[model samples]
Target: MNQVIELIQSHRSIRKYKDTPLTNEQVETIIQSAQMASSSNHMQAYSVIGVTDPNVKKRLAILAGNQVYVERCPLFLVWCADLHRLKVACSLQDTEMVAGTTENFIVATVDTALAAQNAAIAAESMGLGIVYIGGIRNNPKEVAKLLHLPELVYPVFGMCVGMPDHDPGQRPRLPLELIYHENRYDPEKAKKGIEEYDQMMRRYYLNRTHHSRDTTWSKEMAAIMRQPNRKHLRSFLEGQGFRLE
Candidate 1:
């Protein structure tokens, strides 16, 4: 395949990063790449916070379930879904912006994710490694307070970017049939695909962990689905001025 496709397919989450920090030019290029991502109506309802302060990173690491990578990485970027700027624009025109419909919330969140993925690609292309830290959502309120986020803004996720100290092989994805459909979704196709992928993953995990962790993807997914994850998210979002209505 082409270089771009090869680059994309070879993606891996780099948890262990070297102490080497990114240069100012590298940071600018990555952020500029992120800004070029397509946005819904060009609203661009998002913002990113780049943290280099050791003290702040240490506290963030603790807040994010003690993910040491958060503190260890030279650059930690918090990607936020933001509508506060839109509100300001509305106010400038003497229009009271409708702050938090569910649609608006989805748009902002998707926009943030899109921008972040672009940043990831840019970083990877530049020979840097990155990993997304969803753990930041574990303590959204404290994170928001620490970040000094305003209303109509919430942290969607954080990213750790630096030189990779080690290579963790890429994880296998589910069978294509399970995710991609022709036109109408075929339940039978999905079922068969999952069954096939489970066996593939079973072997993969066993091989990867020296037979210490012999589990299938479906089982892991079932365990995750059984528990209510981050039930506090609703209240936190509401408090952050996202009506979710």
Candidate 2:
């Protein structure tokens, strides 16, 4: 297999990191790779904030569901879906713009995600470990305030990047056939794959090198879907000027 393909296959979410800090040149290279990611209509509807200050990271750690890694990591980044620039484009033409609709929200959010993923892959390629911090949304308002974000911009997620203190084995993924159907959908085949996957996950959770849990994929998913997760996000988005319409 090609080097890039091998890198892709061995992806892991790294939490424990060494105290080593990334050089400014390395940070620039990673952000440049992220900028190369495809964007909707080239709007690039995203901005990234790199945080290294201890005080800022401490507050962010608290705001982001008390994820200690946010404060401990040598590099922390917040990826924001931003429509504020588009408004500038409109103003340059002496015209007003409206982007509060659902479609606009989706486009900007997706652009931010695609860019952040490229940065993550770049970090992994350079032997740096990284973890995505979705808990930024646990208190989006507080996060935005902490980041000093402007209107029409929102923090989609944060990322912690640093040198790995130790290697963590790769986690298992769903069966390929279940995810990749060629001609038509196959519910029965997908169902069987999931059933088999559940057992694999049960063994994995029980046997992994860290804190062990007795659980299966299906059981975890059921528990997750049983509740309305991040229910406040709807109101939060609205408060950020993203209209559901």
Clash list (residue pairs), candidate 2: none
Identify the runs in model 2 with alpha carbons over 4 angstroms from their true place: 209-212
Q: Where does candidate 1 stray beyond 4 Å?
A: none
Candidate 1, 14-82: lDDT as tens digits: 999999999999999999999999999999999999999999999999999999999999999999999
Q: What overall lDDT goes with each candidate model? A: 0.95, 0.91
Overlapping backbone residue pairs in candidate 2 total: 0
lDDT of 1 at 64: 94
lDDT of 2 by residue, 86-204 (tens): 99999999998788888899999999999999999999999998999999999998888888888889999999999988777878999898899889987889678989999999889
Q: Quick one: best TM-score, which candidate?
A: 1
